[model samples]
Target: MHISEGVLAAPVLISGVAAAAAGCSVGLRKMDFDKTPRVAVMASTFFVASLIHVPIGPSSIHLILTGLVGIILGWASFPAILVALLLQSILFQFGGLTTLGVNCFAMAFPALLCYLIFSKLINGKNQSLAVIAGFLAGFCGVMLAVIIIAAALAISGEQFITVARLILIAHLPVMIIEGLIVTTIVVFLRRAKPELLKGVV
Candidate 1:
């Protein structure tokens, strides 16, 4: 769920923005030329994957495929997410311009984590393990994003407990769906396009 600009307080938003900037910087600096194609795939996947919106309770949520992004792009997922988020803000108004950094951070942190985890697994010969790793990474990424969003709201407005709770509850199902799809996608890609994940290690 995209947080409206007015929903979060200044301190939380500012902190999120700072973190987002750092993440983007690091992700961009670490991008390798050999991995450019993979990162581009990640950027496109993130942009397209997020289009499958589903309404759980009060808010609408969508699949992020961030774990997939991480597994493919590694640390570069941060810049890729920033790109996708920037476009979303301009085109769909999914997130506001002022909050773009925060929104990017919320989505990108889990992606970074996923990249770390998937990097290790892909180094192994067992394809199944890699797929499983991808699933877990995706699940964690979704959960962490939810937590980040809640934390930002809580920090911004002390009275946002109900809002956070509602968002968490609504996103639970979406997370599960995302997890399943992520796992399946990872396996499919592993079989169909192993080269895409070649340099993630």
Candidate 2:
């Protein structure tokens, strides 16, 4: 989900920028040169996945795949998501430059959180547990992102409260779809490329 330009107050925007900067700093520091190509691929995936979005009030509904990205890239999801959002803004105008930090933080923070919560389980020996963790990571990524976005909108103005509620309602299907998609992908990667899940963070 992307919050359009001029919708947030100055304080929120500044806080977003600061938070994004901190995340990117840590992400860059932890980035592995050997995995640079993987990061680029995930960034491209995020860029393409979010391009087809349905407008809903100030934000939009779309596939983010942030959980998969986070599980694969760990802390690097922040800069990867930032790059994708930047390209989306410049090339398609899906989101504005002014709101880049907020959008990036909204999507990437949940990604980081998912990685922290589920990465170990996904890497564990039990395939069933890994699948469940994958689903939960995917489901929670969207859920948490929605909450963060709703909070941002609500904090901005009372007028946006209804829209925030509508956004949450509209994204229920997306959350489930993401969960299934992530589960399948996690299974495939585990079978074909288990190394990808190890020591990513």
Candidate 3:
């Protein structure tokens, strides 16, 4: 799920880095230091979530839980994802430091968007829509990330288009799997732990 170094050209990497810095700054200001405990819990969730994988064709897929992270933590997701990805990169080499910013934007931006979109869904007296939106958020989120990666790869080298094609093809089943998992989780949470959605539990 992480984009490695040398996969993107210098320009893309630089632009992603700048966007990451801006995102982190905005996310930081919105972070509530007083609720460090919740942040810690979500950080742990985000950390452990990536370890559980589902096989999808040649490449395996993992549960990013970006939707869950966003629903619970809001804008604080930026640092949470940053910390988790850094740990993964250092400990497991799931991604590299050189491509960290691009990967960060790939994952964290969707998380932020999930927060915005889901909040409206849940508050509008449409539980089903909220669940569906949460599901689609996770589904669409990965595609968006893949698109970014593919575009970055395309610009990196003309030879990379085949790799991009493989990526786009490989992720279709993963997207479906993500949608199912995300929907199931959201529905379960809505019925069993509604407080979590309201940002209280």
Candidate 4:
């Protein structure tokens, strides 16, 4: 879902940078110094997860795991995702440097939204509901990112609509896969490390 450099116009790129900067500012402020280790771990997870792509017809799919990070780190997912994307761009050129802001925002915004919407339910008392919330977080995270990506491409030209549609169709399997993965992880964390959910509001 990385928008390559030069694909997006200057206005879109600037807007992405400005919006991501604002989110990163708030995320940095909300991030507790003690949780730096957890953030780093998740950043690494994000970095690795996105690199393992599976070919499906003309398009490829990968596990974002952004929802997993978001629920754990809350707003801090912004900076974590930013760092991961930067490294990916610098080291592998997976995403070009000029498009870094748009790529990061595309991935991170849905993560923040998922955290805000699902964090409470995941932390709530009912296990069943919490599991459902986890699944939704993962499912919706990809869906929202898909929409954002489509919108970004749609802005570039009319022909991109078809490409965007294909991208969404290709990602359908990933949505289900990530939802199940996140649900399982949430259940495990609920049993073994409930404290991770305790402090995050």
Candidate 5:
């Protein structure tokens, strides 16, 4: 979900920028140089996945795949998302440059949160638990992003309250779809490339 420019108040925008900067700093520090190519691939995936979106007031409905990125890239999702969003803003203008920080934080923070909450279970020996964790991660990722976007809208002004609610309602189906998609990916990775899940965070 990308918050359009001018929708958020100045204070909200400033706070978003500060928070995103902090996250990017941490992500950069934790990033593995050797895995740069993998990070690029994930960024490209994120970029492509969100290309098609249905505009809803200040935000939009789209398949973010933040959970998948988080599970594979961990904290690195901050920079990856930032890069993708930056490109989208520059190229397609899906989101404005002024709103990049808020949009990036809204999407990437949930990803980082999901990674922190489910990474261990996803890497655990119990395959069933891992699968469950994967589903939850994907489900929660979209849910959390919706919450953040709603909050940002509400905080901006009372006019956005209705739009905020609509955004939440519109994304329910997306959550389930994302959950299933992530589950399938997790299963495949566990069987074909277990190493991708380990030592990521």
Candidate 6:
């Protein structure tokens, strides 16, 4: 979910930019040259996925697939999300340039969290456990992002409390859909392309 540019206060926006900048720097440094194409592909996926949005409160909701990206790309999701968000802002104006940092952070932080929490299970030898982890990653990633968006809104106004709750409730379907999508992908990869899960941090 992309918060429109003018909704956030200056302090919140500044903090978002700083945090995103640091994460992007680390992601860039840790990036494998050989995986650049993979990064591009994920970035494109994120870019395209966010375009088909279902309107909600002040913004809209869509399938991020960010958990899948994080499990595969690790910390590199920061830069990947940043690039996608940048293009979305420029091409479609879905999210404004001024709000880019917060929007990117909103998506990328949950991705990092999913990576840390699920990487081991997804990379584990037990296929069942791996699939479960995949489901949780996809489910939790959206849940966390919803929480973050709500908190960001709550920071701006107490009136946003109801809006936040509504947004989370509205996204329930998306969470389940993403969970199944990620679980299936993980199962298939474990069977046909296990190498993709190797060396994930």
**4-108, model 6: which lDDT tens digit per residue?**
878887877888899899999999889878778877875686677666675556776666776887787788889988888888778887888778888889888
**Candidate 4 or 5, higher TM-score?**
5
* lDDT tens per residue, model 5, 76-158: 99988899888887888788877888888998899999889999999899999999999999999999989999999999999
Query: By the lDDT metric, which is better: model 2 or model 4?
Result: 2
Better of 1 and 6 by TM-score: 6
Identify the runs in model 6 with alpha carbons over 4 angstroms from their true place.
49-61, 199-201
Clashing pairs in 5: none
Report the lDDT of model 4 for residue 76. 86
lDDT of 1: 0.76
Q: Which scores higher on lDDT, 2 or 3?
A: 2
In model 4, pairs of residues that clash are none
Instruction: Summarize candidate 3's per-residue lDDT along 30-93 as a digit string, tens digits.
Output: 7767776788786897688878987766777777776667777778777778888788888887
The local distance difference test score of model 5 is 0.86
Arrange candidates by TM-score, highest first: which order? 5, 2, 4, 3, 6, 1
Candidate 4 RMSD to the correct structure: 2.3
Report, for every candidate in turn, its global Cα lDDT versus the true structure.
0.76, 0.86, 0.76, 0.82, 0.86, 0.82
Candidate 1 C-alpha lDDT tens digits along 1-201: 467877777787888889988988888778777767767865786688778886666877667776667777767777787888778878887778778777888888887787776767854678778777767877877888888888888787769988888988877786787777877777776778777765442
RMSD of each: 2.7, 3.4, 2.2, 2.3, 3.4, 3.3
**After TM-score superposition, what is the CA distance of residue 24 in candidate 2 from its true location, in Å?**
0.4
Give a tens-digit lDDT track for model 4, residues 100-167.
Answer: 77777888899888888998899899999999999998898888888888888888788788988888
TM per candidate comes to 0.87, 0.91, 0.89, 0.90, 0.91, 0.89
Question: Model 1: which ten-residue window has the lowest total lDDT?
Answer: 192-201
Better of 3 and 6 by lDDT: 6
